[model samples]
Target chain A: MIRMSNISWRFLSVWRRNLIVYRKIWKVNFLVPLLEPAFYILAFGLGFQGLVQGLSYGGKALAYTQFMAPALIAISIMYNSFFETTYASFVRMYYQKTFDGMMTTPLSLEEIILAEIVWGATKATAAAAVMTLVLGLFGFVNFPQGLLIVPLAFLGGLAFGAVGMFFTGITPSIDMFNLPIFLFITPMFLFSGTFFPVSGLPEWAQTAALIFPLYHLVELSRACCLGLVETNPLLSLGYLIVFTLCFLVLGLTTMRRRLIK
Target chain B: MDQQPTAAGEIILQVDNLGKHYNGVSAVAGISFAVRAGECFGLLGPNGAGKTSAIRMIYGFAPPSSGSLRVFSLDVADDWRRIRSRVGVCQQDNTLDPDLSVLQNLLIFAGYFQIPADQARERAEELLHFFALEKKREAKVGELSGGLARRLTLARALINDPELIILDEPTTGLDPQSRHLLWEKLHALRARGKTFILTTHYMEEAAQLCDRLVIMDHGRILIEGAPTGLIEAHVGSSIIEVSGADQELVDFLAERKVEFDRMADRLVIYNKGNAEIEQAVRAGFHSRQCTFRSATLEDVFLRLTGRELRE
Candidate 1:
């Protein structure tokens, strides 16, 4: 029932529509990512650096701020993409009737859904780009290697955005979104090596972290930022790709069921 | 896409046994109708009478559970994109993007049809003027009043220069002034030979605009014809009403075999252009708070669909 052929270049129009809207409020949008890294660096650098000791990741001795900077990028990618597709896309689809309007055009449901996911990714990448520059200025991120995080943010964004859209499709109401954020997103945020190393957790907890899509993103961001790898770069990248593809299909299937019915 | 020119009287849309079911309950049950190339065809019904359901299928918003829908001589299931590219739809809901300005809404919508930039801007400006929304072009959609927003929605629908426009309850919540203005705009568009399929609960709106209309109830067409023709066929030319009627009036109507609705406190008698009937009823019931007037499309609608409230 999910027809891939229904998707075409027409989806870009929907993307362009979101971009037009995004550009209008981009200052408020950029403010969060730009200042968020500074907030975390000051908090961790002043508060946690002296208290935390022997912080070694990928065989490299790292300060608390240095260790947490790349992870902040990972979390931003997750938040930007996940929140956009979940809350923003839900508002457009349900409240604003944006998707309903688009469905009337030559744009297919698949194309609209694809455009939403891609737009979510685009926002995530934009935020990540801003955060990378901020973190690089503080000497927390490596020079050329840190630039790779921008594109990596897009991949991570797609993974999170597709899953977020999947939740948007199935969740009954806007308030019900708390269930996914609490049960899925919150746990991943805490456990997926954002502030602490997964290797330090219990053996089973480390294995479980491997299953979270954010874990793969965190690993990739680290590889790109610190040029150090605990997990193989290809393996982490491949995991995110497969996760994105699987959820992309699920997102389309679920959204088609919800919208086209 | 074919480039052949279509004649005015050609059938632009055809539906055969179209049905839609949501979770085992039927919304539209095997209704069939067609729209010619240059007529204002209408679907008139009560709430949940499958008007929106039927309209959704024609514009490819929802797939029919059964049967076929052909738009512009192309099958909807196989060529919906091609059909949709040439068709415009103004949905019942307020689907306008509140984030964008009124003019940006139209320009962005044009991009959906792959309309070029300069041409889209030109057409967008023309539509803004056509809908009388030129002054509010740069205003946020949320700031516009209901009428202004509705006008913008209609303007956005025309951005593609669509051959067929489907308006679902276009004037549902509009005030009389706005409704009249919209009707005038629609009349102008009809004069231009553009085809339209409209769904509405306002009988006057349907009566004034529809060249032909179908009265639907319980997911089925009860009757279909021109407004005056249906009114004449089903209801009559005139009605005599007597409130606080005595049993004498009821017996008199029964004895005369005059078709009438005998309510608890009122007697409504249908007169099919028989002046004698009107005169007789008026003379008999003139002292009983009686009044006589011409029957309208409302009479036909209420007579067919009944006066019961539908949720």
Candidate 2:
């Protein structure tokens, strides 16, 4: 019997515990979302801009780097939330046994997973904001409208965190995580309008990209960051919200089934 | 005997025909027990005998498939959150956060119960010293030795000032000294009216610490009573175990009408007194050690569960 109402304020305790632990290892974790992706931004920004210095390939865009940077920020948020909820949550659940420790102290399994998602989203939210700030410093961002992308990135993070938790909940072994990372996350990173516009891909590839949650996240983040949303941004935001809520329910149930027994 | 707690207004915990199954296979099959307000109760069993399952149910981690389990008179299914704040469970696995310092583990665990920061700090200091890990307070959990980690875990369970402490195989892998120290700490806590519910296969531990315990096997309780009462009722006052014996010893026992169980290569003869074993050992039959001693809980455990390897 998994109920959404089974969650309560105790989720905050788990969230706070992670915060305390994160404080101790902030040098490692904080840098991954902050500095680790800068190399990607620089390498791709400098390397690819030379080819499309004066032209746009997706039929409508200012410059290629300007077109790709917002997607990169969104993708960065997704990866941070994904890895946070997957390997990091796995370590807490299995290796460090912090999950078991928390369970004995009146925290239910549902509350714990909820907290993991919240914490993962928190980390990704920070990464999204920081990267947006970095993009602003580099003059790649478009002022007040660009600032709006930070919150959309946060919403995308919440959705990806839930997705990460779902995979982590069903994983039978540690090595099985590589399957999701390689199969799901890599494809999203490569094709979700991040490195290049999905419009450039084949018709079937674009259709496949629509099914990936990252694609909606990128659409929302890229539009908000560039002030170039053609349609109602709420459509993409609504998709992320629905996706997050669906997985929130599914993640809690799956993790509770796996953990409490 | 006067120090023994009598049945009071209500017991601390109760289980009635409790059962649990994993995918239709029973783990705890229709067993029941009670823990009083101020006494140490034990569940004694071999590995996979369902002691941990029972403990998990009481703590509300593993829900019962059938029957009722209650703690502090509150039903486990309904009032678990209310009951949980008053209870603490020290699980078999070392659930310590390895990335945190020894003191940090207690502090963070205390926060789970919403203990105030100052009070949690004070209790953390007190438990750190009580468990004799005060010196290692700043050391990370990964850096501590096995004994220290176990001690810290026990210390972490105390952070909430819980009334009922449930320990699962508390001394399973501890050295003799560590085991004794843990037993002493438990005794000291018991004296202060902190009720304990413990699970272990160590018969000696049950005899030493538990006021009353149940011996379980194959997912069911075989017997339950006070340590001495169970031994007296099950294994009797004395016993003799003779190995390397011939059929002559069997015939000799038969002539005296001595009831004994013949294992693969030995004879275990039970008695109402030590005289039977003493006289037999003095008679000098060709054998291994002829043991003569007043029975303890181990005798009762072995008699009920048998000496064969459960594995």
Against the native chain B, what TM-score does each candidate's chain B reach? 0.97, 0.93
| TM of chain B vs. native, candidate 1 | 0.97
**i-RMS, every candidate?**
0.7, 1.0
lDDT of 1 by residue, A1-261 (tens): 798789898899999999999999999999999999999899889988899899888888888788888899999999999999999999999999899999889899999999999999999999999999998899878888789997899999999999999999999999999999999999999999889888889999999999999998989898888887778889899999999999999999999999988
Computed on C-alphas against the true complex, the DockQ of each candidate is: 0.91, 0.79
Query: What is the fnat score of candidate 2?
Result: 0.81
Worst 10 residues of 2 chain B by lDDT: B1-10
- As a whole number from 0 to 100, the lDDT of residue A56 in candidate 2 is 49
Model 1, B202-244: lDDT tens per residue? 9989999999999998788889899999988987888888899
Two-chain complex of model 1, DockQ on C-alpha atoms against the true structure: 0.91
TM-score of 1: 0.98
Clashing pairs in 2: none
Could you tell me how far off, in angstroms, the CA of residue A181 lies in candidate 2 after the best superposition? 2.3
Error of 1 at A103 (Å): 1.1
Error of 1 at B240 (Å): 1.1
| Full-model lDDT, candidate 2 | 0.83
Candidate 2: C-alpha RMSD to true structure equals: 3.2
